[model samples]
Target: MAKMRDRRVAPSSERRKNPFAAATATRADKTGDSASDRKLVTSFVLLCIVVIPAVSVLLYYVKNAPRASHTISLAHQRGLIKTDVTYQEILTVISENASQLHRHYTYPVLAYITPWNSKGYEMAKRFNTKFTHLSPVWYDLKSQGTSLVLEGRHNADMGWISELRMTGESLVLPRVVLEAFPRELLRNKKLRDKAIDLILTECKEMEYDGIVLESWSRWAAYGILHDPDMRKMALEFIKQLGYALHSVTSVRNNKQHLQLVYVIGPPYSEKLQVHDFGPQDLQSVGDAVDGFSLMTYDFSGPNNPGPNAPLQWIRLTLQLLLGSPSSRVQSVGWKIFVGINFYGNDFILSEGEGEGRAITGREYLNLLEKHRPEFQWEKNSGEHFFLYSDDNHAKHAVFYPSLMSVSMRLEEARSWGTGISIWEIGQGLDYFFDLL
Candidate 1:
């Protein structure tokens, strides 16, 4: 019994003596587990590092993009047009029969209200006058008074309601007006002098009218988006315009032009439809303009598939503008006037559809009444009409306004106690005016 116990004990004793073997096995197992654990942890850490930064970068760029796609001009920047010989002759002829032409209280220089003014201004006075409109403070635009003070140190001015004509290769403006800017021109004494000389000579040639001075230009619109260089140039250009106006005021004998520089500001014509007002394209259009004249009735688009200017849009737009100037008071510059669509936006189809023609209000109404009697339109207000449809397809037809319709619109405009302007003397003027 003692020998057997000794044999079992001897095996245990031998195992205990081989300490290196046991230790080696234990060490190997521990090393393998530790290495595997380390790999798992490292992979998780690396993934977090890569993914977090990537997502953050993606989110940053998407948030900062432009909303109201801007339109690029095909022409370079230049001054205002002095006159349109063809249009001038035609207008002169139309104005001759003043009694037949139906005159009204008028605003000519609409700095920000062109839509109300630039039509055929019926005001008998050859000299233009406009009511005041204040620029948007959020966009850093100065009102006429503020703008004058800003550019007084420099020499830039505004021009609106005065005239716009193609003169040689450049536009010959009376002066540029606009919102204010944070630019400096005092440093360039030489440039300032040259600008002054040019302005004085031009003012003398033009020979009359008080100065409508403003210091900035369309830069306000561009600034809404943030283009440092472009804003700078625009501001500088406005300063130059001011210099021109300043010189004019110093020498001019006429006082009519100063009392009212009709500002012509706007809703950018080329802009695409948006869910909300955005990318103020017509931002600075009023800055230098004496009056505002909008291309209000442009229903004939190259891509239009349906009726032109809807009454809802027209009325709402008029209301929106009313925020700046009372539609009633704005009537004074009705002569300065917004433009109505007498022609189509294009002669050809946009995406290959119709010939892209524009129908006059009378024609549009006649066509609608003849084709879709079930769809009707009643006059809403001054030269304005609307569609009436009970069918669910959301179909709209242009109904000719009845004599009552014309009368209603005329009365609505008259309520503003202002002037009214027809777009062009030709191209169906009598069609709408006849109703008036």
Candidate 2:
């Protein structure tokens, strides 16, 4: 029994002390670890070879996927796929883009308001908030002896000023063409200096924001084009007026400097004799003044029976005003405010006598309402018109710019990054307000 117990204890002690056995065990552990490491490296290599290529193909397919296919897939997923886009869908997209544009874009809108017409005063009151500047046609200047004299009477009940003031709109005085005015007065340095003094004094006293110089008298324009001296005097007058006006601050806002706006007729070809207004005048005036109110309308008036402002003509005019290599209208740093006609022209179709008669937008609408005639839209000119026979058996054709045409012009102005100035406020149709 003692020998058997010793033999069991001896085997346990020998196992614990056996160096060869320990070495063999350590060797086996090392062999297992090497196999595991080899398996892990092999798995990594297989993943790189297979998964990397698969991921690269998927990424390429995603990046180069067809837009229509992707859209269709998204629509199908939402169960909203359709065969075609409807008109309403297109309109919705357009309206959304317009709304975004409205939110982002902002510029000045100047409206002319005549004080003589009660309707105009009312319209100015009604639309004060829509306008940034309200220019009242209440002032005119004439050469009296050696000094410039104010010729127009101011309205005693000038409530429009208060109304505009309440809406934070500016009041600019409109200087109309001095009737029967002699061009020689412009050449007189003393007279020009007196005129500048008078204008600045009145503006300061009335607390006016600025003045709109309606200096584009046909005779004056003709003289400027024909006579070099007249052109020089005119340029000098603009420079002096601009310098004087800009030097003074308005009493209304002590920090605000006076603004000078020069109104010029539509730009015409340099080669054309008797152009509406000379391009040289525009370039020079643009240098002196803050802006130029390009009178783009009156292309068709009592004398001419056509679209008031043909879109193509307007495009050419704008291009010229902006300047080109061969064009006479060169760069003269200034902002442009395009004029939009709120009136229309009516022509008597019989005998072509008394052909072109000016009519307001409201008048045009009233005639349409009474006649109920078939109206047609001229696509080329962007004008709406109708031919009708009066009770006297005389035929008449009326051409006018509807809101659609106005909108197109406005879009053009916006595209050119220019402001818009309605010819007159009261003459526009009621629906025209909605466009603004």
Candidate 3:
């Protein structure tokens, strides 16, 4: 039995020592090694083709993406964003801390308020007399046949006006638009006197400080300025109105002189043109009016989209209107209030799209939150703008007045020793008043 067992064990040993068997074993081992090596090569290739490239792409995105620290998310925390409560809080803080920011400018600030937006009412009440004049867009002077009618009295708020006056004694001038310019109203002497009397009676009866006349553009549109005789009549009408306003004493206070602020349009070009209101017109009516509110904004529109008011363009317009440093009219700078736009323009980069839609600060904030696009500061325009795509994949460009833009404009106006007339207070950020 031992011999039989040994014989079996000897076969096993012989099998282990057999060259053919060992070669077969080596072939099997080589086959296994080749399989493992193939797997390793395949994995490395996959890493190069998929995993590595994926990781590289992820790294690239991570590196290139806008950091949260630099985005509106962070800006919101810094009180750059607005809320009903945050608005008041931010204004309080600004009033306390940055009140002196505009001290470099000693000129008066004229802020416009509109009935369409309630924020303007709140802003006027809060800031009080930070504005020398508060013009409420409440009235329209229109012609109803032979008679002149001063409408929009329904929008007036006497309680609000009383409160605003008590706060800081800001002049409450209601903006009156010339909705209709009848030839008879300008040509007929009795009708002209009737118009002036109507304006004066309204001011005295309503206890209003004065009126902001916005008829130049309407007159221009009617081609009144084109005709030299009509232009002279129009200018004479303004002078008569101005003198009449200044001559009257306020019903509220006998000491106060009712002011007449004339709204003028920008030339919109470097060259001298027969515009709605030009330097010659200013020279004609400069002494009659308390201040000339130059509409320096709307430098661009949908048909020709660009900066709302380019800094360089504004400078040139000023030079053209007020004359260069060498020939600047004395004391005219004080009377000339440079217009600053608190609103922005949203323009579609397409033809026949009408004009740019006006946007407010809150709307702009909503857009920033939604798109989070890179806001670009155009040095040439001294404005902040951003590009976005809508659901239709149509590109839109927004040119809004940023804090920096306003500051540069304020500085520019200050250099000319001019006051600032904000288009409307409700359309801008609360902090914008910091640079008032």
lDDT leader: 3
Per-residue alpha-carbon lDDT of candidate 1 for residues 164-244, written as tens digits (9 for 90 to 100): 211111121222343333333223445444444544454455442323333322333323315545444544554455435
Per-residue lDDT over 106-131 for candidate 3, one digit per residue giving the tens place of the 0 to 100 score:
57788888787888899888777468
Better of 1 and 2 by TM-score: 2
Each model's lDDT:
0.30, 0.55, 0.66
Best by TM-score: 3
The residue-level lDDT of candidate 2 at 392 comes to 85
Clashing pairs in 2: none
* Per-residue C-alpha lDDT of model 2 across residues 352-434, encoded as one tens digit per residue: 33355767655665676677655555454555555555688555667666656776676666656567677777676654544
What TM-score does each of the candidates earn? 0.38, 0.70, 0.75
Supply candidate 2's per-residue lDDT for 436.
55
Ranking by lDDT: 3, 2, 1
Which residue window of length 10 is worst by lDDT in model 2?
20-29
| 285 Cα displacement, candidate 3 (Å) | 1.5
What is the model-wide C-alpha lDDT for candidate 3? 0.66
